[model samples]
Target: MILKIGKLFIAAVIFTGISALAVSAFAASGPALFRSEGCIACHTIDGHGGSVGPNLSHIGSQRSLSWIKTQIVTPGAHFASGSTVTINGKSYMAIMPNHKNMPASDVNTIAQYLESLK
Candidate 1:
């Protein structure tokens, strides 16, 4: 019984260490992914980027994390594709591509990063 308990404790410790590493990686990758994933091409943050999509400088202040995730994975859920949507007094076409095939980890990381903007 003591040996089993010891093994279980060791297993738990390893799992915790791995989990911490994963969380750290997730937290660190968001900004990089945002840039590498071509988000900068259409969204502006901190006064940099293109004008194709709505500026995301204060997206976190305006949107929830879950909402951002949904927008990333399935933007059509919020707005019909090819339709015009108004945001912050500006008109924009709902042209953001759907990322349904993107890895969930990337989506979560991006959402968390955007949610932390505020």
Candidate 2:
């Protein structure tokens, strides 16, 4: 009985460790996706990207996670394409491409990353 319990505890510990590592890895993927996914071409983050879109250095404070996700997956839901939209007192044309076909995992991770800016 003692050996069985010990083995169970060991398995639980290993499972927990693996879960933690996976969560951390998923969380870390957000930043890399932000860059590799071409977000930098139109959005500025921490003063390091283009000026076409809103500065996202503090987007978390202004937008909810769900809203960010919608903006990423279907920006047209928020603003029509080629229409002028005002954000943070700045005017910008709603030219952001839709990512409706992007993997849901990538969309979630990118939204999670942007939501963490606060």
Candidate 3:
């Protein structure tokens, strides 16, 4: 009985450690992936990035996680009519380019990060 209890405790500890590591890795990757994927070229996080796209400092407050994910994965599908994205003080009629080629995992990571901004 003692041995079984010890084994269970060890298993729980291992599971917790793995979970923590996974969360840490995703947290680290989210911002890095956003930058490496060139999102900064068009979007701003806190008025510090490019002005080609809309400022995304409060995007999480305006969008849901699933919506953000869909936008990332199939940007054209959502903006077929070519909506206008205002940057700084200028509005440009443009369609967000499709990122369907990006891996699903990376998309999800980015979505999660964006969702956390609120």
Candidate 4:
């Protein structure tokens, strides 16, 4: 009976390890989604993308998950008056085009990726 119990415990441990790995893999998908979705066209990640939007090197440390999600969905709704951004030597009104058409799952994945930037 003791040997059987030990085997069961070992099996449980291995299962848990596999589960954790799977979760990590899922979380890592966020970055890929961000890139595939063209977020890099306007935003910079770790100094690698464009500068049309704010640099997102440490965005996770600055904004909450809910705020990030909202911004992604309705960007123009949150900008302050008189706020502007310069892109490619051209200064434009600080209006983030809404990406409301993006799939919710993909938005969430990109949000997850941004949150991990911290």
In candidate 2, stretches whose alpha carbon ends up further than 4 angstroms from where it belongs are 1-28
lDDT of each: 0.92, 0.93, 0.82, 0.79
Worst 10 residues of 4 by lDDT: 80-89
Q: What is the C-alpha RMSD of each candidate to the true structure, in Å?
A: 2.9, 2.6, 3.6, 5.0
lDDT tens readout by residue for model 2, 20-102: 99988766488799999999889988889999999999999999999999999999999999999999999999999999898
The TM-scores, one per candidate, come to 0.78, 0.78, 0.69, 0.65
lDDT of 2 at 6: 100
lDDT of 3 at 22: 92
lDDT of 1 by residue, 1-108 (tens): 999999999999999999999988665487798998899999998998999898898899999999999999999999999999999999999999999998898899
Q: Give per-residue CA lDDT, model 3, range 1-118, as digits (tens).
A: 9999999999999999999999886654877888999888888897667866777888888889999999898876665547775545678667567788998889998999999887
Least accurate 10 contiguous residues by lDDT in model 1? 23-32
- lDDT by residue for model 4 (1-92), tens: 99999999999999999999998877537778778777788888887887767788898998888789988888766775358855345575
Per-residue lDDT value at 1 in model 2 = 100
For model 2, name the residue pairs that clash.
Answer: none
Selected candidate, larger lDDT, 1 vs 2: 2
